[model samples]
Target: MGPTRKRDLAAAVVAAAVLGYLLVRATYRYFPPITVWTGMSLLGVAIGLAGWGFYVRARIRDAEIGVGRGRLHPLAVARSVLIAKASAWMGAVVLGWWLAVSAYVLPRRGTLRVAAADSPGAMIAGLCALALVVAALWLQHCCRSPDDAPPDADPAPG
Candidate 1:
């Protein structure tokens, strides 16, 4: 499979953000307060993905350079690629959701006590979600073998 396209990711984020905004507008009163734990969870996942990406990059580099330290199994690389793809998509959706909540609440903070209270947590969650998306994309890049062409590279005619 090809690398994930930025256009596709952007479309997903926009679609999710619109839906999230509509949902929050309709039902935010029924929702619980945004909590620190939500942002913390996303931050934790981002950290884990970054760590995994570093490890994968090092292993792949070693193999590419023929350093003989160790070789990554083909299946392991495939698994990593799959996980990265899924995480990137999930993170984009989540980022959009949190961003929408932040957008809705921040502007109303002065008029609504609940909005004021929720603003900080929603913004924090949005930041963490952005981090998750970045880390997932990094992991996806790390999963690529050295021989793989860059995304912008033109293929040679057969």
Candidate 2:
């Protein structure tokens, strides 16, 4: 891999690690009394890790084919996008199902004691988690190297 590609990959790893930590902390704060929240957080972590795994796998393939020495190839970009889309879809479906189930289960079990749905802390934490997922998806789609540009493009005049 070239210096630039190596740098980009390293930066991505660092950013993901930091974001993952923040997401975990926010999840803990949002659902302090529920084990379900921990499960959700773990799911998020797994999704993130899966995405990263895809990324590294793509990178390795690119390197093997001499594509990594240049900019990211279209195939690598496509792989990352697919992984991100899968992760986002999975997270959304699982989270939605959990929320729906909790709505009924909690009330039926007489465990809905907290009456602060409108509480600022809870709202903020929820929003932060949502934002984290959105950001992860965006990052997965947006961070491709310049070499991954579409073919049949005209070179700009110098």
Candidate 3:
């Protein structure tokens, strides 16, 4: 499969944002208060992904430099790519949802006590989702093989 495209992720975010905004506008009244734990959970996932990225980068770099100690496994790289792609998409969707929730609540904060209470939590969660997306992208980049051509480059003539 090809690399995850930024454009695709952007489109997913936009779609999710619109849907989340509508959902919140209609049903936020029934929902419980958002907690900081949501952000903390996402942050934890992002940190794990970042750590994996570092390990993969080192393995790829060492293999490219002909280090026997860094013998990379093809299956591991494949699994990493899949995980990174899924995480990126998941992060974008969550980021959009949290951002929409924040946007909706922030404006109502002064008039609604519940909105005021939820605003900061939503913002924090949104930031963590953004971090997840960044970490996933980094992992995806690390999985690219040294022989792979730039996404924008044309193939060489035979």
Candidate 4:
């Protein structure tokens, strides 16, 4: 499969943020309050993926250097790449969702139970999602072939 595209990721974030903002503006009152667990949950997933991705990247790099039994299994690399891409996309959605929620709540600070109760959680969730994006992108970079990657693509960290 092809690598994730920046434009595609950007589109996902922008579209989701816009839609999230609109959704909250139109229906937050009717919707249930946002929970702190939402952020915590996303954070947990993000951390797990980052750890796994780093492990995969190290193994792949080791194989490339003939430091292991052989090259990594093709399917494993493929699957890892797919997961990395999806993780980034998920990060975009999560960030957008919480960012919109936070924005909506900031203005209505004194007016809504959900907004007041959830604003802090929403902000933290957005930040965690941003971290997820970074980790996902780092994983994608790590999985690249030194000779195959384009000049603009990231190189493996030292």
lDDT of all the models against the reference?
Answer: 0.88, 0.47, 0.92, 0.80
Residue-level lDDT tens digits of model 3 in 28-101:
99989887776778899999999999999898889889885876799999999999999999999999999889
What ordering of candidates by TM-score runs from best to worst?
3, 1, 4, 2
Return the TM-score for each candidate structure.
0.94, 0.38, 0.94, 0.84
Give lDDT tens digits, candidate 1, residues 3-80.
888788888889999999999999999989887666879899989998999999999998878885788888988888
Instruction: For candidate 4, write residues 1-158 as lDDT tens digits.
Output: 67788788888888899999999889887866666666776777778777877777778777778896666677877777888898999999878887888889988879866678888778888888988887787777767765676757569856
Q: Please rank every candidate by lDDT, starting with the best.
A: 3, 1, 4, 2
TM-score (C-alpha) between model 2 and the true structure: 0.38
Query: Candidate 1 — which residues are off by over 4 angstroms?
Result: 156-158
All candidates: CA RMSD in angstroms? 1.8, 12.7, 1.8, 4.0
Winner on TM-score between 2 and 3 is: 3
Clashing pairs in 4: none
**Clash list (residue pairs), candidate 1:** none
- Give the distance in Å from residue 7's predicted Cα in candidate 3 to where it truly belongs: 1.0
Poorly placed runs, candidate 2 (over 4 Å): 1-70, 108-132, 143-158
Better of 2 and 4 by TM-score: 4
